[model samples]
Target: MNVEKFKKDHNEILALVAELRTITQAGIAKNADAIAQQIRTMSSVIKLHLAAEDRVLYPALAKSQNPAVAKVGERFQQEMGGIAAAYMEFAGKWTIGSKVSSNPEGFKEEANNLFKALHERIQKENQELYPLADQI
Candidate 1:
């Protein structure tokens, strides 16, 4: 199952999430450039990570004997698509050098929603899905 690789990826994502949370909070408090850079970095890392999973882990999990686990993996993939769309939408809205202060509340709301969902997904993967994958 390569639990070490999964753990490493999980930790990296967690660190990125922390950075993202700081950047978004700073943006809400009037620092747009930092937020923009963080968003760009996060977007790249996330896309790459998802691509790796879709290319490797998902196919392996789907072919496993456990129907319940495979179904969960499929559902996770769908949820990941939704998260990716949300990230892209937020990235589009908050371009570099844009005036975040002009619409701080809206930006903050979107960032919060995105982070909350991401955090929940990460928790689930770390606590439930990854271990299950290891067992399988």
Candidate 2:
């Protein structure tokens, strides 16, 4: 596996996280439009990154008979399913046809939580999932 390729995606994800951070810190009242834009941008980035993981990383480890590989691969994929859903829901609710939620404050709060979750998941994938995949 060209481990190097994965780091590029990591960097892209990190950049999106930083963008979200800036938007969230700006306060939903002041930056509602900008926040919505960033969410749209972030959603696109994550979709591509996740698709790459599904193509290259998950499948390889998931196919392994080695128990460790199977377990970690399965776990990451499962967690990713929920994360993807939450992301889609948030993005759709805030950036869809109508655009922006009814309550900016509530949307801001959800955005902050989403940022934190993405950050944590990326850390885990880098520290545990990808490393374990490399091992097996």
Write the residue-wise lDDT of candidate 1 on 17-114 in tens digits.
Answer: 79867766554546777777777777777777778778877787798799998998888778888887887887777766365667778777887787
Q: What TM-score would you give candidate 1 relative to the actual structure?
A: 0.85
Name the best candidate (by lDDT): 2
CA lDDT of every candidate: 0.76, 0.78
Models 1 onward score TM values of 0.85, 0.86
Per-residue accuracy of model 2 over 1-136 as CA lDDT, tens digit each: 5556777788887897787677767766566677778778878888888898888888888888788788889889989999989988888888742344358767767877886897899889888877777775
Top model by TM-score, which number?
A: 2
Error of 2 at 68 (Å): 1.3
Q: Model 1: how far is 36 from its true place, Å?
A: 0.3
